[model samples]
Target chain A: MNTEIQEASDILKVIESANKLKGAEEPSGVLRGAQNAWDLLSDEQSQKHITTGSGDLNSILGGGIHCKEVTEIGGVPGVGKTQLGIQLAINVQIPVEYGGLGGKAVYIDTEGSFMVERVYQIAEGCISDIMEYFPYRHDKASSGREHLQPERFLADIYYFRVCSYTEQIAVINYLEKFLGEHKDVRIIIIDSVTFHFRQDFDDLALRTRVLSGLSLKLMKLSKTYNVALSLSWIWRYRCSNKLEVFVWLFFNDRLNTKDMQERRNIFVGDDRFCVLCNISASEDHDHLFWPCPFRRSCWSSIGIQLGSHSDLNTLISGVKDTASAGLFSEKLL
Target chain B: MRPPAPKPPLATSTYNQQEPRPEKPLLLLASSRAAKLSLGCPLLDRFLSGGLPAASVTEIAGESAAGKTQLCLQLALLAPLSPLSSSSLFLYSDLPFPLRRLRLLAPKSRPDLLDHVLVAAVHSPSDLLSLLSRAQHHLAHPSRSPNRLPIRLILLDSIASLFRSDFDASPADLKRRSGLFFKISAKLKELAYRHQCVVVVTNQVVDVVEGNTGNTVAWSSGRQVSPALGLAWANCVNTRLFLTREVDGNGGSVKRHMKVVFAPHLPERTCEFVIRRTGVFGVEPAQRSNNSSEVKAHGYYLESDRTRKGGSNQHKQCTHTSI
Candidate 1:
């Protein structure tokens, strides 16, 4: 825990070839250096969230996202994360009169991806929803004073297009003051947070530290301001990892097999190997176990009565039905 | 005077060019109009505490087409008004410099000041290193123009472009690439301090690690991708500014805000401005300068929503002019 002891230990690790720290000693007392964990808890704590209007997302997130916490959404390209972002920005503008948080939004588009036309469409949908529920009491509202134009809700939201990570970090750090001045503003969204950091990172450790500092600022702003901070990160297919790989793994197998003559490929059918036999074949889901020679041998070797069935589901039930006491008995294993 | 005072310490001096050189740099008097670089944008000048400070590197970072080069063009046009001669160095590192925009922003009178500006394209980090030398050599011996014009400002529009595209930094080569950038920064700092000219470097941004940076590091605060070029280059910077753009209405007119991210003398404040045909101009938030029907120039900074409640002082003399 002591400063000198920590440095000594770090150097010892580096000397022993257990760790690799680039700089001998990191320059201490940089901007917003490491703080006591208790310092953050000293501030007021509240778990309030403005409804995003979409019931499914709100429910999935346990009664909408926490305004006091930062939510980072990452996905492959063309995932419609920006669409969801724009919808949330528009949805956050529901006035207090209509069972909604009367709050404004700030959308920071780093990659020039924020579309005004899309925001307009979403804003119009929100206005119609508001009008349907909280219908104007005055019959001659049009002639009277009340006017609901699409621009009204759109005006409350502010958008910032940032090119560099410095600007991205700057706008985020300065957002505290912006939020304070514009008290009504309650949401901040950045489309594709990793757009700039993908290419040139001259110093990895330094970039991590700087990124760590900026990340701290975003969370601090969200908590202090009690506003939702949502940012989306996009990755291409070639560099797919994390969520992309997770999704791809489950969805990679195809259900239907198309015509082999039309498609320009050497393998006739699916060109997949059955896990049972470990041999290549024109494989689909049904052929993986049943109907195939490898699967027939696997079924016969186990002494489970194999029968003719139209599909895999019926075949599964056929085995289950015939194996009454046999299910309880141990197999060849 | 005083034989140019021995070129004090690579850019740390606030000597205000008083040590003297070939061309007598303007006296950095508080009252003199030439003391500050105008930047042609009044709100920017006011926010910047009388424009960019001399003998320091000011980074104007933003996204592509965030009016960085536009601001650079404005600075080049107003370079003549700086403490020294009208000349400047515009190094296009990413893409070709927009000559049409430069010509448009150039002052009709003293069009030759445009000629005083030297333009060069940087291919790589090594290329940039050589270009820096060529700039110094050219400044030392004038051959292009009739009269010697000491460059008072150096604009490297998006300095990260070439570095990002060319260099690939693995753990083995990280030291080499960073050392190269450090050398470049040292030279730039020397250029800035010795000549007492402004060095405005533009850098592109990147995304913070999504699930990566947060869990590994000590982020009780949160996570974000730090700006590009890392701390190696960040250590040498004097002032860092960020430009963020946002559209006001369906009309698609963007409102740009300039934030002083880090600087010894400047506060971290963001001021809103609009880009017009002439150049970038500051706009009052209440007025929404781009939109006139909702707001009139006559109105003050009163909330539009409060107009229905308060009848008193419905009309007042405008204290500020926007755009």
Candidate 2:
């Protein structure tokens, strides 16, 4: 028993010592000590924004893309999510005197859609914008000419091409060590984080988990390293929500009613009786449009019989066929 | 004969060091008090006696769309939210991971919960084996992983998929497949034991045809469905939870049921749950009792045939009421 007690104590001592060494050896910036809200606010005030090169865009974005935050840029394919990513990669390197962050960028291309030629052109455009805007001082312009070269802008941005999701994860995992060595990197851009993820996945739940995991890691990296993490993804529309919006816009007057039974819970009213036919049945989409006695009479008077089906497409197509057949028969006679 | 290895710094080496370890009893005593990871739902966690237990393999077997994947995803998301603030490793061998559904389930405050869960896709048995081996190395060297928090939860979405397509039913093939299953489970058990991690593996269920009485699984959703991979694979898991889904009486929504088929600590139990956009929620006990009583009054009752030797049949049966 004595020996056991001594061994336990010895193990505990080793554990404590190992924890201390781990704490001491941890890299400086990775360890984020607790800070109050006031400190956080003050830090935000001191944080710099990388210019997006458009004045109106900069104004709306609160002086451009703020550092120490992960910003997701999403839009429909070809709406220029990648373009914005490349522009930011170039614009992040704008020199300090011009009120820019004056830091390099790390661009991770997952889609292989990143074009070096377009990036060079954007870099040229950025350099020209700087010279035109800050040409008040002749000496400053001359001295900054060398720094404003397009090639120099291109050189400052490090590009990594990842072919698969696994490669994407591996690159992201290596980023911490990379950032430690290259502190000048002010921004990291993943050109379409959803490419390989969207394809070849048999299990959708796993995809969500994997993508969420990646986003979480990116968020931590941005917070710890004080760099702007920009992630681009194919802007997705939730089909149900979008379809509902469209249907509401087109058929709102026909479908939605104040005394409708579906709205009874919301209005707390007793008038759920069908407004068209006073058969005392509750007013709903089916009762109002499909089976209502009044609606049947209206259709009969128009010489177009209606079916019991609730599908609007079939109903409309049936009506068209009846009308056309009647017109053709009249002409044939 | 092994060569002497170089010593790591004393303070940095304590937690992971294998030699000079504390006595077995002391280790067990400390681990017994160690916190279990929550299943996210309060009631389910209570039913699980805290949450998923460490150092054991738990299998969740269910048919398609039975919410097995959703339950696993919920666990992955919840592991980080717990006070332990530990990370998880999700090994997906099935379909594309559902990022949108997970986002819907994630709480508003910590949308970044996904970041704490590391996910890897394994296409086949060999791929899964290699990944597990590599994972063992990564867990041993905590510095190698991206997140600071150690992985306390390792979830394999479905174990049956990797083995289902890769092997034929030939006797030799079956033997090889069972060997692989044991190898995979052993690796998972080792990792769970060494890291004190909770290992959860989801499984696919195969329908049991009538007249085939050989090792048939129980009935769920009025149809006989049993966990796939037969008895050989069943022996590897420490605990088994079966999920079943049936259309509600109203016919608008699905009512999901989870039952503990076997576990060392937990009793044979069953519960009703619903999957919402927020997360999976267990039905309250009061509501559950009321529901069962109502069903019984309507001449219906849950038939859980416990008398069967190897397994029990759990299904809802209804009797006609003479009006």
**How many collisions per candidate?**
16, 22
> Scored by CA lDDT, what does every candidate get?
0.57, 0.66
Docking class of 1: incorrect
Give the Cα-based TM-score of candidate 1 against the true structure: 0.39
**For model 1, what is the C-alpha lDDT against the true structure?**
0.57
The positional error of residue A209 in candidate 1, measured at the CA in angstroms, is: 27
Q: Taking the tens digit of each residue's C-alpha lDDT, what string does model 2 give over B133-181?
A: 7887888888755656788889998899988887889996887787676
| Candidate 2 regions with alpha-carbon error over 4 angstroms | A1-333, B1-27, B144-147, B210-216, B291-323
Fnat computed for model 2: 0.00
- Candidate of highest TM-score: 2
Q: For model 1, how does the per-residue alpha-carbon lDDT over B101-167 read when each residue is reduced to its tens digit?
A: 8898777876776776788888788788788877776655666655747777888977788678756
Give one digit per residue, the lDDT tens place, for model 1 in A132-162. Answer: 6556632435432143555666676676654
